[model samples]
Target: MPEQVRISLDAMGGDHAPDMVVAGAEIALKRLPHLKFLMYGDQARIKPLLDNCPELAAVTEIRHATQEVTMDDKPSVALRQRRDSSMRLAINAVKEGDAQGVVSAGNTGALMAMAKFVLKTLPGIDRPAIATYMPTQRGETIMLDLGANIECNEDNLVQFALLGEVFARVLYGIEKPSVGLLNVGIEELKGNESVKKAASILREIDLPIQFAGFVEGDDLAKGTVDVIVTDGFTGNVALKTAEGTARLLVHFLRETFRSSFWAKIGYLLARRSLQRFRERMDPRRYNGAMLLGLNGIAVKSHGGTDALGFSNAIGVCHDLIANRLNETIKAEIASFEAEMSKAEAKNPDNVPEDTAQ
Candidate 1:
């Protein structure tokens, strides 16, 4: 028999709480047969929605919690004080082994804070970083520390690169994924002290990953590298900027095409291709962000995600569970630790120093 994946979803989280959350859960259950969802929130509101779709009742189990953690509450306070918050309960399900993973579209800070407290980090990993998959010219590149840890060190960047490589290989099916340190310049001598030191450490690491030197902001959408590693601050800025640019460009395209009859006719003539382009560039298709270097799987979705976006996140969670991504990451990290230890023993004084403050 195949392994069953039970996911705990915080139904009351997100801007479209309960409604979109419920709808996404329904879509996931209908599309994926092996998925079992534990919806955590008030039962009264969720039941009516479930009643509208009787068939989903069989696959989804509701764990009622009266209170909810709003996006405004501090994550630390919410985690400690709100014992019955839906987000906390959902994470508890994963921590207690009642569910394989937890998915939420709540406050990003609170979710990260709660996740760190509940799931903890894998061995040899100091912190877990938020990683997202971006479509690049080369294919899909894994961008790490998107917003998880704003202040990171050279050690963090190196570890992020390793984790990103493993994720790309497992999730994207890229063998020996080329790794690049996000920097202001492509030259080896560019960037701050941290990036410079991280590049050196990466060069010394003997792993299956192919270190592709430094990459710039323009290189992200151009698909110059498979995995882009940077501090959370830089990565978050780059990701948001890219997202804004993509949206602006698409908006402009739509306006241009709809402005005149000739353009509308042209759009109609190329409707299929236009739809394909939209699908490819749509951020909703890549809504899930993985909390990498964790002991267990925890996926975070955009706080404002709609039903369709949440559905995409569910599909991503399903894919990660089905592929046993956490296990694969565990093995890869272990191997990396062994390699680092051996290298350290051989050249204890020669190990590159971390430049991140």
Candidate 2:
């Protein structure tokens, strides 16, 4: 049998804490026999949930954490002030090698702050970006820096593209994934100064992946490119907008179908296709955001996630751990660094700061 992958979960991190979190843990344990979970939170609250699942109780362990970090709290302050908060404890578990990965539905800002502080960045990476996959007509596209760092420079955008490319290649099994810079227009001269500068740099570099030029917001759901790169602020806005629009469209469709007997007949005729479409677009299927370029494995879920969402997040963590994503990313980054070093040595003065070792 394969060795078990242990995960540290923040049982009190989300809006539906202790219930959804505990329920997700139970589902994960049931689905993955070789998976062990360490739940961190108040024992009193967690114990009652665990009582219903004796099998999970046998394999899972609970670690006591007294403090809780709220979404409104400043990330830096929470990280510094709350020594025993569930988020901190869960991250510490990964840092200390007690768990192979950490899963949380906690305050994203605080989680990112604490993760950067604890896990640190890989050698060539200046900053860690949160990457998430979304289902699209073509398949799925990897979008990065989703609300992790709002303000980014041209160099930051380039790094996010490279990181996102490697992530798509590894996680989605795409060979030489095509990377696209999120822009307002597809023309080379379009977008702001930062986008223009990044595009110029991207054109100059000869990366292992394919650079597909610029992609607009509408191109995201169409999967016009394999990887989409942008600053956290833009990426976050685009993601939330897509999610909200999908929800709204689904609601409108359901209301239209239920309005009349004729509409009900039409709905029944298209129900199978609609069901498949809904399944493909369901946010629960893609619930976790990966903190790429970090040394350790850290997966973040939506703060308002329910049990199904949390369970899917655990499954994502399991897949990442099983696939040895950290090792693969490290190797890819090392290769990129070596290539950059060689290029710099040959042309020292002209080497771009973004690609320079």
Candidate 3:
């Protein structure tokens, strides 16, 4: 680990203000004593909360900001009008080298707009993708485009594949990770033009990626592929459907357990197993959604998540900084662009005749 990894927090962005933010910082510090937080928000609101956790207060330095971006605020409005807001300041810390990353349970659009404007995307990247982890049968898998870009082209999908590949390799240390396109079927003719073209290009690329063809909705939870690439629309729909299904299953399970006297007895005996299942399904463990492809790390926590969930978001930022994820992504992108450029130079008019149109 580096000497230190400091994180900037938008204390007033979430449903719970300074209290949950400060408490979450305390919880994160317990696990990462070396972690430092630049708390940006109303100092009067946060100082009292810090008083309750004296140790956390020692490592945290508060920066007073009277303004805050509310949930209803438009991304454009927040970016243009709220320069002194807590969210903007936290992101500015990253650009200014005061922190490696920023975590916020703030307005998603505002946060994204401000972050993009401030940190900017890395070279060779058109738009940043939102990535998050999901528990799978084998272990855990990372998925991208969780509602960042609504529409994408062949190049966009291919770039998302690259994004996910670097994330898995750096975060999980997977030597060679398999990538798949989310589609209706596994056939070559499946999906729209963008996905088909993306798949075709991935097959012929000289990259060190294991392209696993196309995967349907069923393959997501089966751990069918290490990374599933798709446009933001499909990815967001898939995410919401999965979440709704999980909630329905939980409700049915709870009712089933309450159905009979014998069921309660069975539940008592299997309590530990059920508890483990609950822990695996806990949304708090997967609280942070990363705005991948930025020059600096920016993680967005769920707006309504509690203190425990916010702490997990901070941990995600910590992991990214400690692993130098942006640097790794930059290196891969440079290699990818260089190889493609060499291929173009081989053509007479620098036009890829065999390339997909």
What TM-score would each prediction reach against the true structure? 0.95, 0.94, 0.96
Estimate the TM-score for candidate 1.
0.95
Alpha-carbon runs more than 4 Å astray in model 3: 347-357
* Predicted candidate 1 versus true structure: per-residue lDDT over 1-357, tens digit per residue: 566789999999999998999888877777887788899999999989988977777778999997888889997888887679889899899899998888999888888888888889988789899999888886777899898888887888888988898888888777778999999988877788878988887788787779999999988888888889989999999999999998899889999999999999999999999899989988888899998888778889888988889988888887887888888778888888888888888889776563222
Rate residue 254 of model 2 by lDDT: 90
Which scores better on TM-score, 1 or 3? Answer: 3
Over the stretch 224-309, how does candidate 3's per-residue lDDT look in tens digits? Answer: 88999989999999987888898999999999999999999999999999999999999899899999999899999998888999
- Higher-TM-score candidate of 2 and 3: 3
**What local lDDT score does residue 11 receive in model 1, on the 0 to 100 scale?**
92
Error of 1 at 52 (Å): 2.2
Candidate 1 Cα outliers beyond 4 Å, as residue runs: 354-357
Pairs in clash, predicted candidate 2: none
**True-vs-predicted CA distance for residue 114, candidate 2, Å:** 1.0
lDDT of predicted model 3: 0.90
Judged by TM-score, which candidate is best?
3
